[model samples]
Target: MTKDLLMWDETLFRDPEVFEIDYVPEQFNHRETQMRELAFQIRPGARGGRPLNTICRGLPGTGKTTSVRKLFAEIEAETKKLVPVYVNCEIDNTKFAVFAQIYRKLSGHLPPASGTSFKQVFDAIARILQKEEIVLLVTLDDANYLLYENEINRVLYALLRSHESYPGTRIGVIAIISDMNVDLSREVDPRVASVFRPTEIYFPPYSADEARHILTERVMSGLYPGVLSDAMLDLVVEQTMKSGDLRVGLDLLKRAALNAEKDARKKIEEDDICLAYQVSKYLHLSFTLRTLKDEEKVLLKTIADMSSEGKEMNAGEVYTHAKEVMKIGYTRFYEIVKKLDAMRLINLDYRQGRGRTRVITLRYEPQRVLDLLA
Candidate 1:
């Protein structure tokens, strides 16, 4: 059989596994304080005491999920008193699904997906915990999705009020969210809120130097020494610092290397990095846009279409024009517009003028929207 010579030749990457999002490094820099605080909050669980519920909040890619995973690993390693179960609320946002995750984690198997009611799952979990003499520390990652689905209250009630159904069963939750502006106390049930006085731990955005150091560490571990240049690394750091998302930098590095490999190049150049950045931006924006409702997407398209250079349009003007694009009632249209604004997909500026005039502008580049929607 004929073989391709490049397969056996020197490659740009030494170990591509390090570039993966889930890859936890031996040295987790820039997040020691958060990690230590997490360990402290959950230490009581090791002694059969109730661990303090915690809220880990920050922007995406700021190590909220990573920190929690690291802590879970450490907790499991140290003692068997607490069972750490992690659930991504984006997938298991509902009470039944969330409880099923806990059931699976505690019982080593999942309850029947169908045929079994939520109360059954809840009771099973309680029985197992009481019999096993284990405290459950559940981490609800991407927890903001629960709030959007209006399931946060019920989910919290299920966890915080487990003791009501089964006495002496301790359940501690670590809620991870990207939106820090959300007021958890008001959103959750009053009873759950009173009990779930979480110790909030915030993961701030990485600075330029921190981003650089992180990218440098990843590059050294993931790629060959000479495959990426210092100048090229700077480009990634520059973009990451602006976005304040370390995920972007890591993604850019990995994608650029892949693109270079595709082009039969030995090293990643500036052009490769730039191209990867554009692709990454498009992917990120498209993912966010996909999450919007149909009405919101139409409103976003209208804003991108009607917006002019160095100027914004009034909400009234955009609404009038949006009807031309997609017909809808005024009240519903206004609500979708405000929803998009809240989602940060558009810039909504309320002007102080003769009337309560609100201006709206497309937050993203117009061409990008055209490309994605097309």
Candidate 2:
């Protein structure tokens, strides 16, 4: 190992060109079988075939998006049979926002965010597809968000039913939901749901050995050669499996690499791995808090207060409690709570088999969010 004050150019080492290295393979690993099956779904050009509705459910960074991208790339290269597009559902949470994203992406221009009429925006999208003579397979990544906003049905209706109005063009949906329980079929209108039965696949976290292989390959390929110890790779792989998040592994590698440079060291050791783990936790927890607005924080605290007082409630119930306790308007108060639910700072589950009056249950322990604010 080099001396702490060694003449290593930390910045140069800080940014190792990962892909240029030993082909960091996590983004593309153990996915061949899945990709092959996904191919036929998106390949609308096959005779006697129509558009396919497909769903991929997995933990964060389990390669849901990466796998789809890889499959689409193969489809694009080998066959011009279809047009493929992907959208991050988090970025398009609202009905209008989802429509706008599709419109702008297809039109090769950014849609007017608010001022333009909705009809004009959608019309432009329709015209573009017709003029280009393209059939699209739209992938919505992190699609559980659409359900939280109560916009999943509307979005599906627009994409699926569009063909009825414009027989010249076709739009097939490929929805990606992160959790196993996120239900797309339940959310779709029955008239529309019949047309939307998708091939669903689940992605499990890589095992310790598999994760180690994946992470080691990434470290060797992405970081300074010979920088990480065997122990460091093992620890990272193990922790990643525990977290069920490949992004956490990626974040650790990125942070540990930075810390090694900060210490003026050319090689990353086990201590750096420990530091990296702590830093990742700090950042993830901090990001969760940082994304919450001041009002959202206060409202969460209010929910925490109610939950602490032994009152179990749903969004509507919490909204009432928040109104009575804080004297905020019903509209503003409920809106903030919904945002909190969307952020995963709170969980909202409706009572099963219940009608329109069913409400949501908070998923996380209220104290956790409360402490973040305090």
Candidate 3:
């Protein structure tokens, strides 16, 4: 059997284990103090105390969720000390749904929204909490989605105000936002916004040197020795940082190792890192495309096609072209185009002192869209 034939066999591609990556912080480092302070806030409650509300702000994969979860686990260990609840707002973003989650965490029941007043929910929680005497701490992850929907203040404001109903019970919010220092008062009530201002922790991206340490830590723990050359590791880490996300770093490394292993290669080489970059780009673009609406997709595709055709079009030109390409009218087309810009699927060219003129750039190559759609 030729080595190349064994290397090219499909069996290695079918290995299910290759798809999984360990997300533990030991394999991932460079955010230690941020993790420790977060752990300190929620882990201390000797039967009764103020529930700690911490806002964790950072770009995605700066270990925000991981650090928060780690802290939650440490706090949860003291059974019956302080009740810890973690809700992902991205998945359960509605006011009723988030409140319902809080209700379930505290009451162990999922009551329907109909015929149930917020007062009723609080009364029930008060009765239960007075009986059990537990401090309820809730962590809302990816909380910006809820705030964006305007449901945050409604639900959170109600809960915070619920002290009016149950004088002794405590409820606090831990909101996570992608932006570090964005002012929410522009959108939220001044009173409600002030209550959320106590403690804010920002997680910045690792420095290039720190990123290298993180990359090395993962490589040493997860891969065989000599599998990755210094050059290969640097390339993987470099490409990962280009996305401004660390999951990309970890994912690129994992994919490159699997690519090497697939080729019947014991030692992953630089070639595998290059292949992983292409694969990661394809995956990121595919993810971005999948999240777009049909109208948004049409706008993006129209822009991508124009860019492929070497036309330097502005926002107005793009919308004008969308009418010809997708047969959509001007009114709806402009709305879809704005959404695409907001989502960052398209880039706009604007002068500092001037208004938003038409010049814009398609964020992806047209052939990439075709490959993904195929």
RMSD of each: 4.2, 5.0, 4.8
Candidate 1, residue 311: Cα displacement in angstroms equals: 12
Clashing pairs for model 2 are 22-221
lDDT per residue, candidate 2, 1-374, as tens digits?
Answer: 54544375345243455523122343676766677668777666433235688888776667778788777676677644466777877667666777777776676777876788767876787787778776777888878877766778888888888868776767888889875656777767797788788898777767777777677767766776667778777788777776776767877887887787788777777788788886565444545566455676777777777777666576667777666656688778767766666666666665655564435454555666566678
Candidate 1 local lDDT, 24-46, one digit each (tens): 88778999899999989998888
Q: Which segments of candidate 2 are over 4 A away from where they belong?
A: 1-8, 11-27, 45-50, 76-81, 282-298, 301-344, 347-374
| CA lDDT, candidate 1, residue 216 | 94
Assess every candidate by TM-score. Answer: 0.82, 0.80, 0.74
Ranking by lDDT: 1, 2, 3
In terms of lDDT, model 1 sits at 0.82
Candidate 3 lDDT, 1-374, residue by residue in tens: 45433344333332333234325453336678897777666644544776566778887667787776766666766577577777877567677777678779877887775998766776777777667877777777867656645577886676666667677777766777764434443556876776655477889887778878877776766665666788887787788778776767777777887787777776667888788878775554565567555666766777777888887787677777787767777777766665555445677667443665757776777788756755
> Sort by TM-score, best first: what order?
1, 2, 3
lDDT measured at residue 49 in model 1 versus the true structure, 0 to 100:
88
lDDT of 3 at 296: 66
TM-score, prediction 2: 0.80
Task: Evaluate residue 253 in candidate 2 and report its C-alpha lDDT on the 0 to 100 scale.
Answer: 82
Better of 1 and 3 by lDDT: 1
Off by over 4 Å in 1: 1-10, 282-341, 347-362, 366-374
Candidate 2 lDDT for residue 236: 80
User: Per-residue lDDT for 139 in model 1?
Assistant: 95
| Per-residue lDDT of 164 in model 3 | 70
Top TM-score: which candidate number? 1
